[model samples]
Target: MATTGITPSQDDRSVAELVRQFSEQTSHLIRDEMRLAQAEMSRKAKHAGAGMGLFGGAGLLAFFGVGALVTCAIAALSLELEVWAAALIVAGALFLLAGVVAMLGRGQTKQASPKPERTVENVKRDVGELKERHR
Candidate 1:
């Protein structure tokens, strides 16, 4: 059989070429998507790092500020009471502050509940289904 037009072999070649081109284009698209994702992740990571650094700096500042206040209190007490009594008084005050802070934190935690109603219902439904299945 002699074919003058595009034969089966020619059609196959064309289809293979088209598939190859499509594969190459798809590969390029995937690479571009990966690059975009990497860039976005790097940007977000930089932002998170900067935020953490700012929080650490704030914590350091607060620590030093409290130390300075305690030193001032000790000095003020020294002028009125005996040195040991002044130290004891400052220590007692610090303990009281710690106790109050702990109590406030506990109260806040007790008041805070972030339960999801939908999730609870879904869990209950699943449990009921499981119990029915077992029965």
Candidate 2:
């Protein structure tokens, strides 16, 4: 047949040549898939890292905010109570608030999974396709 884009049938290709082509194409496919997985994982890792950084920043800012609030409250209350007593009460309350904020940030950081779930799923699908072709 003189078809413009038709491929030669199996009879036209030697077994060794077919094997070699198959091997080369399979290797290329695996490499391409790995590269894709790596890129996807990199993107996922970056998001996870950003989440952790934000959590850390929030915790730090919360502590600073609590300290500032405690200072302001202590100053205001010192008109009635002695300075040390007012400072102690404000410090204890503010510290509890700071602790709660820190815990919440920790929980959020823990929620961000580092796994590249999408990449794993794609690889699994590729493997399933290959198995189908084999059969």
Candidate 3:
């Protein structure tokens, strides 16, 4: 007979012992896999959190940039008039823009209906057709 590398002691073990060893190995493998998954997710979460912080920093910088641009506009206008007058003009223009945008947003909101009109109509039509077919 060809030697399949089974030692005498290993070959002497009962079927139940072999099954128990297999179960133990399977449990260990599952535990290792779970640990690996946990590590991978933790690493990914750390990267995502860092990315979000960077995005927030970028947003803050952009806001400051806009503020700087607005100040520059006011300074340019001040070249022709007083500083206070230039500031007031810019403030008024910004307020006017805000009002216009608010009005447009309100109009769009008013146009949006809570009910799904098209879907409701289609369902009603389908029900009516079913009723006609049954009759």
Each model's backbone clash number: 0, 0, 0
* Model 2 bad stretches (over 4 Å): 1-10, 92-135
Number of the candidate with higher lDDT, 1 or 2? 1
Q: Write the per-residue lDDT of candidate 3 for residues 1-135, one digit (tens) a residue.
A: 799998998699899999999999999999999999999999999999999999999999999998998899899999999999999999999899999999999999999999999999999999999999999
Error of 2 at 92 (Å): 4.8
Clashing residue pairs, backbone N/CA/C < 3 A, model 3: none
Tens-digit lDDT track of model 1 for 32-73: 999999999999999999999999999999999999999889
Residue-level lDDT tens digits of model 2 in 14-130: 889989999999999999999999999999999999999999999999999977887889989998999999999888886898899999999999988899888999999999999
Q: Is candidate 1 or candidate 3 better by lDDT?
A: 3
lDDT per model, in order? Answer: 0.93, 0.92, 0.97
**Model 1 has how many clashing residue pairs?**
0
The best-first sequence of candidates by lDDT reads 3, 1, 2
Q: Largest TM-score belongs to which candidate?
A: 1
Best by lDDT: 3
TM of each candidate vs. truth: 0.62, 0.52, 0.56
lDDT of 2: 0.92
